[model samples]
Target: MIIESTWHKSSYSRAETNCLEAAYMTTGGAVVRDTQNRSLGYLEFSAMEWSAFLVEVKSCDL
Candidate 1:
């Protein structure tokens, strides 16, 4: 049930099995989901927002 979008694992995740996975939406948005369940609902973020969020995450502020 996995939709193909070139998902890349999160570098910050260190889980043994389940980690974070992300892909691009058709509308140019970002889709983030748990790797453990591809059928689960994903969280979508705008390009600008995703970029800011990443910065926050990288800075350990999130």
Candidate 2:
């Protein structure tokens, strides 16, 4: 029941210590986490939720 996904870091993250990673789940959702503290786990978001979040981020609304 475990799903595996490839995590990717943002290209804008030039500093190793200050980076976030994201992975797309098999269920069509996504997960995001701090690259520096991966052992802490990640935040899961549904596909719609993830899209809304991306829109807000791009618009600087949050």
Candidate 3:
């Protein structure tokens, strides 16, 4: 199930549009959505998946 959360963007993101917003899930995961079209809904990731994603991102492997 998806949990409601406060959406936020990367600190490095400066553009007002086309950016992605993410929120923490109470169940140790995350939800992501587009900044431009919130009505499109969001994507959820498990904690393990989320951690792997962050590792890839930090290593510029994504």
Candidate 4:
């Protein structure tokens, strides 16, 4: 897979655990990956999916 060139670390990620990083792609949507092992490939999510995920995250339902 061709990784996006402008990937950025998410501010929500914990400085201690180093879990997730996210970035917007030129084609649209976004990419999400584990900061500790980015080479494993990332999971792509559409804008709607990401928005729903954020809502769930804010709800603390995890």
Best by TM-score: 3
- In order, candidate lDDTs are 0.78, 0.83, 0.84, 0.79
TM-score of each: 0.68, 0.76, 0.82, 0.65
The list of candidate 2 runs beyond 4 A from truth reads 1-4
Candidate 4: residue 44 Cα off by (Å) = 0.1
lDDT winner between 1 and 4, please give it. 4
lDDT of 4 by residue, 1-62 (tens): 34467777878788778778888765556789999898998899877887788789899986
Clash pairs, candidate 1, are none
Q: Candidate 4 — which pairs collide?
A: none
Give the better candidate number (3 or 4) by TM-score: 3
lDDT of 2 by residue, 31-52 (tens): 9889888899989998799889
> Mind giving the per-residue lDDT tens digits that candidate 1 earns over 27-50?
666889997777887888887888
Model 3 vs. true fold: TM: 0.82
User: Which whole-number lDDT from 0 to 100 does residue 61 have in model 1?
Assistant: 98
Candidate 3: lDDT over CA atoms? 0.84
Stretches of model 1 off by over 4 angstroms after superposition? 1-5, 15-18, 26-28
Per-residue error for 19 in candidate 2, Å, reads 0.6
Global CA lDDT of candidate 4, please?
A: 0.79
lDDT (C-alpha) at residue 44 in model 3: 92
Steric clashes per prediction: 0, 0, 0, 0
